[model samples]
Target: MKKHLILLLLWAVVGVSARAQKPATVTIPKNKYGLQVVSSTALYQQLVEQNPDQELVELATYIPGLVLDIKYATPDNLVKEPVYTMATAYARKPVADALKKIQEELKPLGLGLKIYDGYRPYHVTELFFKKVKKKAYVANPKNGSRHNRGCAMDLTLITLKDGKELEMPTPYDATVKQSHPDYPHVSEQVKKNRALLINTMQRHGFTVFHNEWWHYDFNEWPKYPLMDIRFEDLKAMKN
Candidate 1:
């Protein structure tokens, strides 16, 4: 009888320890197309803790003199409505570190970086698809965007002294052929500026999105999973 009682106590302790060791399960509802997203803040925090390299590092914090002109935070974007609640930009640690180096290189030339968007939540991409209805410009919700994984950035070059943006192929989110990096009709000055931006970003481990001159994706974007955690939740996690 004493042996049986001891076995029961040991079993109970083992069960408790097993439960405690289990990682928190993040439960984001699968989309209509059966795509899973990481929506739980706790799960996101757990991920950052487990893999510090994949943590979504704030860009403004790491890149000195970086300017943020988040168009989606205002009603200036294609949707003509504010989609993001905050004007913050985030990227994976390695991507952010690469941008830091890019910023240093640009500083000597009297130029800086102005960010339009980064690390968008998965739900925002879904909404963009619904509103646009154009498969070419918007990311299909079935496969989330690189931005959802914190590996994509929409940015342009800016003059450091005046904080004015350099002339680019086209405005942000413009669905036009001129936005293409290879478009040949732009003036010499525009071409030069666009080339400078793209070459600099490329030298720092980023590749410009074929459709958008200002959009760039980190080489490791495919390694991260789709995340739906909101900026407010991320801010709270930092605090």
Candidate 2:
């Protein structure tokens, strides 16, 4: 009788341990546009377990001295209202790593990056499509933006000493023709500043968006899945 009881207890302990070791299962749901977005924390964790590079890293913490000026977190964006709950930026592990190198390269030149946006949630891309006047400026929800993949960055150079913005062709988020990276009407100084930003980013495996001087897409963007996980949730996971 004593041997039977001990055996039963051991079996129970083994079963409980097996269950505890199993990862939580999560389902990724498709949106109205029939796109499967990784929205839940569990789903994101699963992906990270499979590929550590899939993790969304906070840029400010990952890249030392990285500045963030997330317009959508305030009322200054094209939406004219706050889209993000927090004024923070995130990108895939590799993207953040690349930006860290770019920051190091720029530091010696008395310049550094000021991020306007990064890792936009999928829902915000849908919202921008509905609100923005120019369709060209916003990504269609049917096909998610590179930003949703945590592989795109909207940024520009700033003077590291005083943190003053370096002059570009147009202000961030501008939809005018002058916003195009190759626009020729800008002053000589603005041209030089824009070229510096483009060249530096290009050297670091980023391609500048043709229509937006401040936007750059990581070459490996297509490898990352579209994500809609909120900034608050991502922050919680980090803790």
Candidate 3:
């Protein structure tokens, strides 16, 4: 009887300890738009483990001949601060897979994809809103950016030989009217380059944002949660 009692005691202790180790779920209060953000790494991991398709995957590992120039990791961005701790890009499984296809398509044409940003954390969006204080260029935290959902990408076309970026209507993250997809003031070559990019992405299940030539949303964006997991945490999980 004493042995059985000891086992029960041990079991109770173990159970309690396990429960304590589990990270508490982060409660994200809905913004005015009724969007619930996923701000906890634990919750994001649980969702991914439960449904592998929901995983935020590293782009370099998934795609070949892909160049990543994550601007948020540098001070060149509008925020004027390194918003991301690392210069890496991530996207959902389907988004990455689609990019891979796009890369393959561009290879024969001596062009490839150069990523500017992907999979932005929710907190970063809040920071951008606070800094920019305008909805014209920055996404309102009330409605988390598609990047927070790991379903958007900011990229430009680059030559495969010299890796030179093609001339677009405007630079990445430019907030000018020239950045508009239908802006008619651009030179013919710039127009051609922009058309090629928009057409290629559209053929591969991506829709270009009207204002940002570099930004594209994966058609399945609505299915994913707005994630705030950091790049370091995501890298640690892969290991």
Worst 10 residues of 2 by lDDT: 22-31
Q: Which regions of candidate 3 deviate over 4 angstroms? A: 1-34
Error of 3 at 91 (Å): 0.2
The true-versus-predicted C-alpha distance at residue 80 of model 2, in Å, is 0.7
- Encode model 3's per-residue lDDT on 114-219: one tens digit a residue: 9999999988988998998446878888888899999999999999999999999888888788888899998999999999999999999999997888899999
Candidate 1 overall lDDT versus native: 0.89
RMSD of 2: 6.1
Compute each candidate's TM-score over C-alphas: 0.87, 0.88, 0.85
Question: Which of 1 and 3 is the better model by TM-score?
Answer: 1
Tens digits of lDDT, candidate 1, 1-239: 99999999999999999999986754546767787677888777777776788688889888999999999999999899999889899998998999899999999999999999989998999899999855788898898999999999999999999999999878899998888889999999999999999999998889988889999999888777789889888888889
Worst 10 residues of 3 by lDDT: 23-32
Which predicted model would earn the best TM-score?
A: 2
Q: Assess candidate 1 and give its TM-score to the true structure.
A: 0.87
Q: Return the lDDT, model 1, position 186.
A: 94
Number of clashes in every candidate structure? 0, 0, 0
TM-score quality measure for candidate 2? 0.88
Alpha carbon deviation, residue 235, candidate 1 (Å) = 0.3
Of the candidates shown, which would achieve the greatest lDDT relative to the real structure? 2
Ranked candidates, highest lDDT first: 2, 3, 1
